[model samples]
Target: MPVSRVASRFAGIEESPTYAILDLAAELRARGESILDLNGGEPDFDTPGHITAGGTQALGGGFTHYTPSRGLPALLEAIGDKLLKDNGLSVDPARQVIVTPSAKHALFLSVMTLLGPGDELLIPTPSWVSYPAMARLAGAEPVFAPLSTDNGFRLTRENLEERLTPRTRALLINNPNNPTGNVLTATEAEAVAEVARAHDLFVITDEIYEKVRFRGEHLSIAALPGMADRTLTVNGFSKGYAMTGWRLGYVAAPEDVSAQMLKVQQHTVGCAGSFVQRGGISALTGPQEPVEEMRAAYEARRDLLVEGLSGIPGFVCPSPDAALYAFCDIGGTRFADPAAFTTWLLREAKVAVTPGFAFGPGGERHVRLAFATDPKTLGEAVDRIKTAMERL
Candidate 1:
């Protein structure tokens, strides 16, 4: 038989570091290793009771079929309401929103809607692993704009402009950033708006971790002046509501742009799950206490991780402002690349962490740890990491 090959579009792309680390950890666990799996960004909590009940009710009520390709009307309205109340953005539920299977799909749809082959997207370095991959999958080039660790890895005007080219079509910002867990302040968001407006670039802001902040407040770039029309806001129930398996996410954009996104979505996965949409509605409308409780627990876990890791000889980790991760710099250690160090930690200490280079070149000497687990486990993981480094 002739040799078989995949498409040329996948030439440089690789599996997401998050999932790769997770799979390795699972395999180790299956072999009975005492592994602390800190590579995943999923919330450790279960879906809230009210939301689960809503899904059950939808199942009992026979909502097993497909919903509108855009989404169920009630879920769309609930999403819009949540945006207005929480993020200060008012959107037309009918024309401006499309719920997809996951935030990852929403992002791919956004890229397909706004970009084409040869177009470039400006992405901050050490960002979520999926953003650049999504751009590549859309046949667009990802131009990484390195955000300085000195500035808390926050995006700035100069950095965005440095990567700007005529081929550049959009800017992708993951506020409450995935690996670093840094949130953009209002001032920083304005800088992004200014640059995007000047460059005439569309902005895709992934606010999936909007509800997981620890210090400063979360600011949406879409809420900035002159940015609403050009910004596509991507959010989901995965992190905030512990609905990772539910796979419910939505994008809010200008009417015309959203309509095009819906056209792309219509041809792709078609829509989000039917009954899951009902559960999403309940997640957005029910008492927000569980969200707050989960946030508090993560915050405590973050403190435990920071305190424990700080005492180690060569680990330098800043307190994450939001999200569930700590992107720690292991540059001072003997290991120049974090991949070897992380693998050694897994083998010797039975602790799993995501290597930083998988994010971008700027993350070469770092590792990312998700603090979504309880304080006890996080503390133990930190202790093990410290002891492992001592042996090095």
Candidate 2:
């Protein structure tokens, strides 16, 4: 027998459950079976034309070398302008921001730079699958504060306070959250801000889905009173601009933290792709008409998916006000175990979804279906789901 050589950091972290679903779907595909995939968080749209052109232009114009690790000057300036205009934040582009390969990278950088052994990072679940994994990788304890399913998984100050301990150093938030598509209302954002204030906790908020909003204004916690200095804001062009393959995102943090993350960037990947950074600038500052149009399409798809799911027997789905997923409760169904239900959907319904336990505590009896596909495909998925339920 070979010696087990995996390090302790890899102990509790299994492969990402989201990716595991993708892997399973791939296996079914390999066997030549039809699979209706509703598991990915990626947008189903093309990158806006101007943004692609911007990247091509940069490449053709000989901007293919390593950029400053912090990012190109123009892109940083555009990001700064965006924060001031859209998020009510004013930041110095040079000292406060670092562009990375993706929002996931920005998160990894933030986690690695800010956390260490014995420190606690507060995560409110049902959270994105990566939050706890990132905390664990940083050698920090991930304390999950599960939001109540009774209240539509809404964020409340009490859930966070209940999980607080002396070792707690930070809170990570994702607005217009993935898996559950719940956008934080003004009151909820304030609840987070208040908790952060009372405990002196730094906040690392992921706003990747900010522009995909379908309801009230998306608020940035950093824009709240007394939060500016203690918040690290991460945003990217993946969801909104449909540039997932571009692998680009940026983090706006306190200057010192930005410096430390920059060091991590220098050692790992050096800089983001030169051309992608240029495209990011265009995505931020170019024509926003495509953004508006795509959002309208997503809004329509959300309505369709929600209505369809609501019609299914024993399925309870709240219309997500923003983002690309429909988080549904299957607790009332005959196949009440989310893991078992997920398998049944794949085997019988030929429909694939992520089990809710993949997200965290309160999501146990649910499953998340991404609505990023075309309306026809989404409709078929819903029909398949209903048929599967009827036979059960």
Candidate 3:
């Protein structure tokens, strides 16, 4: 009997490393083992009451039909206002916004629209794992651009220019970056915009973690002069509004690019859920106290985990400026790599964490611990890590 085979393009990529570790942690919990999870990146808080109430109201009002291929006009207008008021990026609701299932989907649609055979995308190292895979899925090659740790994981004009090729079609960056949680300074962001203009390249700025900052102000690269036309701004409700289960995200791009991306959206997943989008409208326009409360809680957890790990021998925990993660260096430890150390830590300490290599190069001998949990849990995980270090 002949068996069906998967496509050739998918053969090169594997599952997301973060979720794989999460599955292992789940299995341990099923077996009645006491496992501490520091691997998942989701916020522990629930969606606010007002937002859920909006969804309920929409359902009762018979808002279950499919919306416009782009999105509901009211939601689009609200997002446009949000981009202008909060991000300083002005966009047209009628032609520049498309609500999607998740931020990840918005990214995939953008990649497919901008990249094709023989095109290349510049992705900074230690980025979220999905960017490279999305590029490959669009039949484009992903080129890695190395960032300096001493420079606080920012992309300098020189390093970015060196990686540019004639085939380069676009550049992608995540502000308040994943894993490292380092926010780009105003000067650094201007340098990136300058490089993009000089090389005539498009930019995709993922500002999903913009609201999770602790010490720096969030600015959109698209707001810079001449960048609004060439940059695609991606944001959503998952991280900022604690509405991950609702799965709502959106992209603001130039009119033409938005049209192309709509074609992709029209064929797949058509439109974001009607009721969920109403919930998103409430999330954007309603009271923001819940968002602030969640941010404050994450900050406390971040401090607890980072402070506790600082005293562990051979471990160096940097103070993260934003996001719910702490990417620590384990280079001083005896382990050969982060994967080996993670395996040992899980078996001996009963704590699960994401290995650094999963992010990209420049992440060797490091691990990313998500602090999106309660303070007591984070404290316990820290103590367990200390004990595991003593054994090592």
Q: lDDT for every model?
A: 0.89, 0.91, 0.90
Q: Is candidate 1 or candidate 3 better by TM-score?
A: 3
Instruction: Give candidate 2's error at residue 64 in angstroms.
Output: 1.0
| Residues 1-392 of candidate 1: C-alpha lDDT, one tens digit per residue | 75548898898698776566677778889998899888888898999999999999999999999999999999999989988988889899999999999988899899989988999998988887888888888899999998777876777788889889999999999998878888888878998999999988999999999988888988888888899999999999999999999998999999999988998998989989999999998999898999999999989999989888888888899999999988899888888878778878888899999999888857878898889888888988988888887887
Superposed by TM-score, candidate 1 places the C-alpha of residue 281 at a distance from the truth, in angstroms, of: 0.8
The number of clashing residue pairs in model 2 is 1
In order, what is each prediction's RMSD in angstroms? 1.6, 1.2, 1.5
Candidate 3's TM-score reads 0.97
As a whole number from 0 to 100, the lDDT of residue 269 in candidate 1 is: 93
- Quality of model 3 by C-alpha lDDT: 0.90
* Model 1: CA > 4 A from native: 1-4, 18-27
Candidate 3, superposed: residue stretches over 4 Å from native: 1-4
Model 3 Cα lDDT, one tens digit per residue, 1-392: 66549766786577887676677778788999999989878998989999999999999999899998899998999999999999998789889999998888899989999999899999988889889999998989999997766766777899889999999999998897998998888988998899999999999989899888898888899999999999999999999888889999999999999999999999999999999999999999999999999999999899999999999988889999999999998888898688878878888899999999898877777899999989889999999999988976
TM-score quality measure for candidate 1: 0.97
> How good is model 2 by TM-score?
0.98
The per-prediction tally of clashing pairs is 0, 1, 0
